[model samples]
Target: MHQIKSKLLLTGAAVIVAFSFGLNANAARMDMVDVSNNNGYMSTAEYVSMRNEFGVKAVTVKISEGGTYKDPYAASNIANVQAAGLYINGYHFARYATKAQAIAEADFAGQTAKAAGLPVGAVLATDVESQEANNQTKTTNDRNNTAFMQEIAKFGYRSDIYTSGSWANNKMTIKGKTGWIASYPYVATGKNWYSTNHAWQWSSTAKFRISYGGFDVSQLNSTYYTADQKSSVKPTDPSAVHQNNQTANKHQQANSSAKWVKESKTYTLKTAVKLRTGASTSSSVITTLPAETTVKTDQAIIQGGYRWVRQPRFSGYGYLATGPANNTLEYVKISVSNTYYTVKSGDSWWSIAQRNGLSMYSLAHQNGKSIYSTIYPGNKLQIN
Candidate 1:
């Protein structure tokens, strides 16, 4: 089965399931619900109702910790969300000094989240920035975070990453994992995938009363997901489809003319648009995009009285319907050289360099890490 993703630029039509809803509603929330152990332990029958009443369609529950300790109240909180029939998700607070530590924590987090009722289509994220780089270089710390995310992916769930925008851009290896950006006051655009924030977390306010404690609310923008992904946990191993194409290349938007007539193009959405499963309007909506959304396409097709742009894989939704005559999605910039590698167990700088036919010093220097430093399994390495 295809992997469930929550990234800005996922590749492949069958593998992407993300949420890309921007165009904020002033001060109101326009996305999912994310709570934690800090929200207190309560078994309120209104857990689901209150969320539904507030327009909450999904819930992100904290399951594991920055270390190995499980969230004390995660099970109860998860049960309430599950019992309430809300979409289920979970995250781990990362606290890793080594690649091994990150994997162990990811294993613990995945197991805990699974037992606590994490659903199939739901995402498991590594909450970085908590001791993410205690004594190590930023590269080492980023490897840990990437390893944590990769280990979580091994358990069958799609992976996401949570951290500040500055940290993500300047300090971490954020290629493989989809971004769940935390930026207060919400920045409209950044260096990541979206022109705006993808899965933007707007606040940590304690104003919303939930169950036995207060909950934090967030907003979704420039990202979206599908219902099948939100379904209960299943036996489908997303690793089945794992490859270099799983994540979008930040260096280049690959494969134009595969869908669109052009190789790299851009467009804007004037209205809320839906990606249809087929070229016809009557086809099922694959995903929905917010207004003013900007996306890149290499192809377009005319059908159902609408001009549909072929979506680059992992750009969240596919086949964006552009009605605004001014709407245009084109490629703007390209990086120097986009090269990467996913670390495997027992792999190190020397081994990676030798295997890839790269010089040890060059590889280390390219990734901004020392040759003597530790590289974790599941983290993606920038080769050149």
Candidate 2:
């Protein structure tokens, strides 16, 4: 079967079943699952759910494709899976037709896998079901496939070959290497179809009620995770993922050097505005402040073609734009304070001036009244 995948972008879903354990004739075998960016960002809870709800013993994440594309979610997925107490490995989609090309692609895949934190000596399988390989002669395909796996071996990783059962039986002869054969039966009961291979990918449309979509799944034999292989283990709290994110956000905030003018002011938003992490339109948004919301700002800065105002927060500063750099078409501005007040029974010029931040003489003069003028509650006075 030809498995088409986007060369650089995340697409589809597949699971590689893997586990590392000592070789024992009586050890109960476990299944492997594969994931790529198409699985989205898996949380530790989700990984735990997969383990508890569906019995996913181990995971193999797609690490890289071709020579230049590294799967964006590979590192995070590896970490989450490990944090959830599952063994982890990595795989790369291969596109090489010659020995030299295989070596080059293997080098790229090996380095990318390492950078993504796949433990050294974990199974690094080359997914060789691309259409480019189907067009090459069997000799060419086998020779270069061996070259690819051999090159990755130099990087201290155990190697395997992932291909369709038909390809393994017909088009390619990856002899002596562990095989991960993909063959979707009418019903995937986790039964091993290719008995000689180390792993059997029994279904590409396997779905569990706990997961949102279908996935490719495999049934792995003990050799897929032999005693010699290094397996991923939980090194920190799974919640540390969120902590790292918070730290990165702090780092991003610290990177800005905008000079803010401090002034306590309140403004009413004229339109919905984005609260950002930084003083730029391109910065990541924290939230959206709805129209007519009143917000207090302790500082403001002009940057990135906008007037950004800082709303002091206990965690850090959240910024929103007042308007464009030219200060036209404003989204928010200083709320108008009362300019006129009605005289109360006990109100005096001095009391009015103190409340309005004005001098007694200025308040009385603005209101056309003497400082000692007797006023009733209904008399209007210009407090400004």
Candidate 3:
């Protein structure tokens, strides 16, 4: 839970006991990224971008780890930062302790960052701490950190080693690699703190509340950044960035603009899933919706790796599992009891009926059309 920038002064025998601090009382030039898992949500992005407010300059995100440790919503978070016009960088929670292991992690981090289209200038930081090394001696930690930083250079990106300031000064050798210190709220004063330090992670929580996306808060120093790093990554709106084409989210505008003729639509839940009190999995579970159970949703959004839908009379979104284990949930759109549907691309009477849980025979009958009739994209289906 730390970020970067700061200075320290003291050398020789007295270095450990006496060191200087540098604090920028004016945070106007400072940038912030609340470091935490809460960033998995995009509401933070929309909140920050309102009125073109440049409250922060950049955001840091998790990119990869040893196994399937990739952040589920990393892409969404990155896209949100881009839409907010903020510089985007990423870090990996280190799991390796040896040079070979560190190299492998760096390779994974490089590939993941590349696939995500992270800006070239954004620093790829490595989170190396005592726990990452299992409380190994400083000698072993120094060798691994040095090797990891050098390997990251192969990816054509600058690298910074994130460690506690105490470790930077007293525990290990950090001379070759750029240092990002994670000493919180203990701003050093006077006499120009350590000049080698490039960033200061000053707070985990304070001031603005929404930025607390479950992460520590820190600001980066421009001195350690390149001109390109300052360029805000302008990404497409996060709502539209998806690697898969889910039918439920297609041509969403038609429904967005369509006038609702009914209060709710019937949907058959093809598989069992949880109906939570809120959109996120962190929300309390209202009930476990069993397989083949009928569920209804008036509103839905892609969030927290699932389609959080608002069931009828529910105060908030209910979590619907989108993972492989329970992904058979379907949004049935049938022409039942005077229901009408605006045609969408590739939509037909049979397809529409099937999608909505209506019998093809009954759907064609209510719409005043034969089974062989053709329905254009814009045609409206009225089932009475």
Candidate 4:
């Protein structure tokens, strides 16, 4: 599941509105449809068709990618799926190489899901079958996976891991974790081949005699529908779900504003950056602009610990992060001057000189100031 942002996926909205409306936990089998950007913009009709024709009772949508990309269609697809009367869940494409990175990506996934309107208690699985992830040791992967899921728990969501059967068995251990395994069988069997796992992706080209492109289909068991299984792969009572939903709703309402600064300028991405619907990192991602890509911005904003620019779009505008405010690690380069560095808070003369590979005196002399002269944030100093 090394799917990029362009080919991400999602689930239905109605699943959470009334979890018991059309779902039975003790049923022998249930089907779930996972969708993303590759499926194109879906309609409520499509979700209805999925539910009625294919018996898809639940959906697991791709809500975010790595630590920065949020699927732009997630919000719309989630709404449509809900209207079609199917349960909804979420997944994230994992790209973290370290425990810290895993925690950050988990926070990003949690925030993206909440912002996209996924109700609390939804299972937010981490897709951990990326090549870079597989290259690492199993110990490292398991440790990081634990960190990712723990962070997701903090946002009032249950967690799972999505990976191949072989990887789930050998590359990492899901003994204590909820496992959603992917393994296409030679023959179409309603049974989960990986019986020990909670959910089994049985077909990549599944069709229930409906006229549509082949979709990845999976068999979900009773454990998949449980609302509050923080650990273990077994089903549990969801008595605390309502309280969690209320608490999470309060948290979202309190911290959902972005700070804006109107300014028009051209800039270049120093690193790959996600273009989002708003200035916040939790906002839906439109697309990713690779490093060195030049774009024109009509405004700028600071939110979620990073500075972002508002790039005008055909429909409205998209936000791209310039970088974090407290550090010199800028991802987007201001095009005003290539040979200058803008002073940011917490930056000292020596720190600035060190970052520019210059002596403090040399930097001070170039800027026509004493080495001991105090520098302030937003002051541009010549570096070349």
Per-model TM against the reference: 0.49, 0.51, 0.48, 0.52
RMSD of each: 22.4, 24.0, 17.0, 19.6
User: Going through the candidates in order, what is the number of backbone clashes in each?
Assistant: 28, 8, 17, 12
The candidate that wins on TM-score is 4
Can you write out model 3's per-residue Cα lDDT over 1-384, one digit (the tens) per residue? Answer: 122221111000011100112223223122445332333355544535421332345567778765356766566666666665555567776767677887888888888877776655556788764233533567877777777777777765567777665567445666632676665323322222334566666443233333321234454453453222223332233222111112111222222232212225445554456676766545677887765676665654432223344676535445443221011122232313456788999876656754553445456666787656778888888742
Clashes of 4: 12
Query: What lDDT tens digits, residue by residue, belong to model 1 across residues 230-293?
Result: 3332213323212111221111122111233332444455545666665544467776666566
Q: Give the lowest summed-lDDT range of ten residues in model 4.
A: 1-10
Task: Record all residue pairs in model 2 with backbone atoms less than 3 Å apart, i.e. clashing.
Answer: 14-34, 15-33, 15-34, 16-33, 16-34, 17-32, 17-33, 18-32
Model 3 lDDT at residue 134:
32
- Relative to the true structure, candidate 4 reaches a TM of 0.52
Sequence-dependent TM-score of model 2: 0.51
For candidate 3, report its TM-score: 0.48
Candidate number that wins on lDDT, 1 or 2: 2
Which digits, one per residue and each the tens of the lDDT, describe model 2 over residues 239-320? 4322322332233234233456654667788767878898755578898888888887777664443457889888998988
Where does model 4 exceed 4 Å of error?
A: 1-30, 208-211, 226-384
Which ranges in model 2 have alpha carbons more than 4 Å from their true place?
A: 1-30, 189-191, 226-384
